[model samples]
Target: MTGKTTFEIFLATVPGLEAVLCDEVRHKGFRSPSVVPGGVTIRGGWPEVWRANLWVRGTSRVLARIDSFHVTHLAQLDHRARQVAWADILRPEVPFRVEATCATSRIYHAGAAAERITRAIHETIGAPHADNDDGVLVRARFDQNVCTLSVDTSGDLLHRRGHKEAVNRAPIRETMASLFLRQCGYSGQEPVVDPLCGSGTFILEAAEIAARLNPGRSRHFAFEKLATFDAEAWERMRTVKSERIPSVRFYGSDRDEGAVAMSEANAARAGITDFVTFARATISELQPPEGPVGLVIANPPYGTRIGDKKSLIPLYRALGQTLLARFSGWRVGIVTTESGLAHATGLPFLPPPAPVPHGGLRVTLFQTAPLP
Candidate 1:
């Protein structure tokens, strides 16, 4: 039987930002969150699982490590799967799906392993299995003959904050955007600005954070479907509220009016419109808001998605000029795939972090400490 107060939990993240997610998890009070490949692992009960989904902005999803055992072959896998106490976690009336993967193991066929587990579940717990994409997912991975099982507790990726109803091509995922902000040393205390704010994701995130609003406040999680989930406790957990008088506001400007409008609508949906401003203007038109200088960050086009590198150099140059000329005291963070393009900005950035995979390209965030 699983302990009533604790369970194994993994916070999923992209490969490059494992340390970033780990920092966020530790800051959020998770017990002994350790960095692991493709994610972070923490041992906690259902409330900790729910809180991670709701409050930790850097994770892509939250996974509960439900069960595991050793199995050399399909028959052993089937026998062990049948003995697992599925009724302790899953409801017989609710449907689920299994996805199995095997590597360097005797049971090498993923489909056969999945079928065996599904049949066992049907016979043991009476919960019908559905297609993988549509229902609660039970993931089985057999690595080196050890079968491990987990359930995806966050259904839609946590990046889908459920508030951004509109976006343009190549919009950054909200989770990545939040991690980028944290990497930039933004604590939501100082003003933030995004010159190429495609859908105002950065601005909205900054505002909500400054106001002490939870990132998952407006959404639901897949854990709600599990038998261990307590609806009454979850309701109370989500209702825990905090309000802050933000220390400063956020600002964004984009050359495309359509992007500006989209950012505005997204901010309204997130209930952070009052703390942020979006205007249709070119990068050359960007000016610091009325406050102490803060961080100026942008996810400018990197030629792979929008245009030629030669064509974007002048745009980057103009951005560099604007910051150097008018915003002397502020810091800067730029995301781009091309080192040449980043050099084009002419800002004295520290060494770049390891490249992060985004939109099919390996991109890095080039950041500067406060400018002289």
Candidate 2:
């Protein structure tokens, strides 16, 4: 497809962070973006889809809407699906898969819907269809009797930035970490500290942002397999050389020696070790990095995920007390599932935002102004 051709592109994000994702999209200079229930929508063509996958940080996936129509039954869906010019986007030699979901529609069988779409693609475009490990994904949703077809341009979830092999339990995804950093008003102009850094997601994400590195630089995208793909153009887009040397350094510390090692290794893999520091230190031993008062953000062990609820109270108390005593002049952002644990910190927090769903639990960012 030509870059001039316009189409709807959906930037999928976690439920509560749609606004934040939209803000990021808009700031990235994409055309008129609007917030929806689960994501943000913008109008563009194939290049925009590829660029979105390349530059945007908070989106979980980017879906390029192919077609949509109202259908009451399976026969109509099959007919309309066949009418779509799949060859324009999908290459016949590439393997593709269709996943379907039905809700409040007369055609209610998800498997049946997927089968029909698969048949349509096979018969019309001659593309090989498979159920396993296909690089191209077609998402068909039948909502309120209207079926919408979209192509998943991002093969892997955006958080898997092709780095960071080591992960601690209950680690925050890189996408959510970026959005939460944005929510805390972090502009990458100052230092960031994650006392409970698990595999250094926040510190690495902040480092990348400060350096203006493209999140999708190291990964391959599904769009590369499509007929619309321009290899030379993509090479030019990904290798634009826009990174800068950050003025401040990011810090991560954990009591576990293994976690400290994991963070160090992850930082080295991300090519930002020169701009980050990781060490083994408990929350009680937390100290601010000298030279600037920045943001101290931590995704501590929520009780449900790591331990008993009552047992974590003292941990929260100690974290709060240490920050209150020594980290004055620094802002704080804590991600937790329980309000009680957050309140135990005794920091004066601003009003909380909507809780974001993470790992089957709704987690909220409890943020505070610069500590006095």
Q: What is the C-alpha lDDT of each candidate?
A: 0.89, 0.92
Q: Residue by residue across 1-372, what tens digits does model 2's lDDT show? A: 233399899999999899999989998999999999899999998889999999999999999998889999888888989888798989999999999999999999999999999999999989988659765999999999999999999998999998789998888999999999999999899999999988999999999999999999889999999888999999999899999999999999999999999999988888998999999998888888889899999998887754587789898899999999999999999999999999999989999997879999999999999999
> Model 2 segments beyond 4 Å from truth?
1-4, 305-307
lDDT of 1 by residue, 1-372 (tens): 355567789999889899988987898788999999988999988889899999999999998888889899888988999888788888898889999989999999999999999999889989988755767888899999999898899999999998999998898999999889988988888999999999998888888878988999999888999998999999999998886879898999999999999999999999887788899998777788887999999999888644598899999999998899889899999999998899898999899999989988988999998988
Off by over 4 Å in 1: 1-4, 305-307
- How many residue pairs of model 2 clash at the backbone? 0
C-alpha-based local distance difference test score of model 2: 0.92
Backbone clashes in candidate 1 total 1
Cα TM-score per model? 0.97, 0.97
Error of 2 at 335 (Å): 0.4
Task: Report lDDT (Cα) of residue 27, candidate 1.
Answer: 82
